[model samples]
Target: MDLLFKVYPNLNVEEVATETYLQERSILSARNDDVATLNELAINQFPGELHEYLAADKAIEDDQPIKNRGNIGCPIMLLRNLQPRDGLCNGTRLMVIQFATRVIEAKILNGSHVGNYVFIPRITLQPSVSETPFQMARRQFPVRLAFAMTINKSQGQSVKYVGIDLRNHVFSHGQLYVALSRCTSSNRISVLLGNEDDDKTTNVVYPEVLL
Candidate 1:
């Protein structure tokens, strides 16, 4: 948001210069009554706090979610599943084709949909699970800048290159594996490990079930 607005043409209309379609009223449900707000907040809030907390505890520092204000020609990732036949999916990568105050036109950069143009519209979304609080749903644009994405979000997608920085060691299960596997081959990875940590102490993961 801050970066997108600063670096790209803010397509938000003057009448609705709001970054997210959700308002404060959207954050208080657990049955997906406010999906967009929950997703945005989930992207921006707890994960960030967890990252800082982990950094404070000497865990990974580079795992925080990116909030990019999308710009023309910049890359982006779809935040939700959409038209698969035209190559749009949960983790599809794309390039901005055109931007309107309320609509975004993009070209597919990944999957079978590569080279295709897509018109993304505001959507309603809900979690498959209902056991959690704030399981609310809301409607909004379902995209995020592709400068970087969280490991949780990066699953099932293959990228050309992978960079792993363990400045703060990985804190969750399988984060290392997921990060490593995102690249098609080992030759495409570049890892930065500080001098003080042993390799074994760094690529930490849980014992059994994991992502």
Candidate 2:
């Protein structure tokens, strides 16, 4: 199970280029260039409203400083739910809180189950289990949700403000574009950084064409 943290700046401007290019080109490109490289470049230079929106989104995810909104509006919090997809532990119930914050802490009632409030730590606070219950439980306690998300889940949603967690290395360029484009305007986004290492990257650019 992976935990998402909130640590990014706001989504200030719309990256119009990437969005327009993606619209013109399908996500599946014929070229073999790493998608991250293309996203890093194309998103910044592409020319279009959507591209600009996506670029701004990428910028924010990269930890560029932006204005901060005290609170987010209509913010949809997401968690990576872990259930066994295969054998032995297959179908076992487990969940990982990807993003952890005081707000989430309060909302989840300190790992208390929302449906029954049974205080079942394994169900509410534990991560996926593949070993001894104690080991899993130990691992679960440290599995704090502290990573930001890419735009994968932000699409088709409207909100006045957005908080993104861009600390995870697994986040791809496509996810960043999707996350940033969700914002309608510059002032509507804010990004949080969970660690200093997350602050090292620069603007993302995508390849102009698959080669």
The model with the greatest lDDT is: 1
Candidate 2: tens digits of C-alpha lDDT, residues 97-197: 12223222112211123211111121223345545434222112111211122244334444333454444332344555555555557575555444776
What local lDDT score does residue 135 receive in model 1, on the 0 to 100 scale?
A: 49
Candidate 1 residue lDDT tens string, 118-205 = 8988665556776745344545568865544566666766755555544446667667777777777777565545568765445565
- Scanning candidate 1 in windows of ten residues, the lowest lDDT window is 21-30
TM-score for all models, in order of appearance: 0.55, 0.28
lDDT of predicted model 1? 0.51
- Candidate with maximal TM-score: 1
In order, what lDDT does every prediction score?
0.51, 0.28
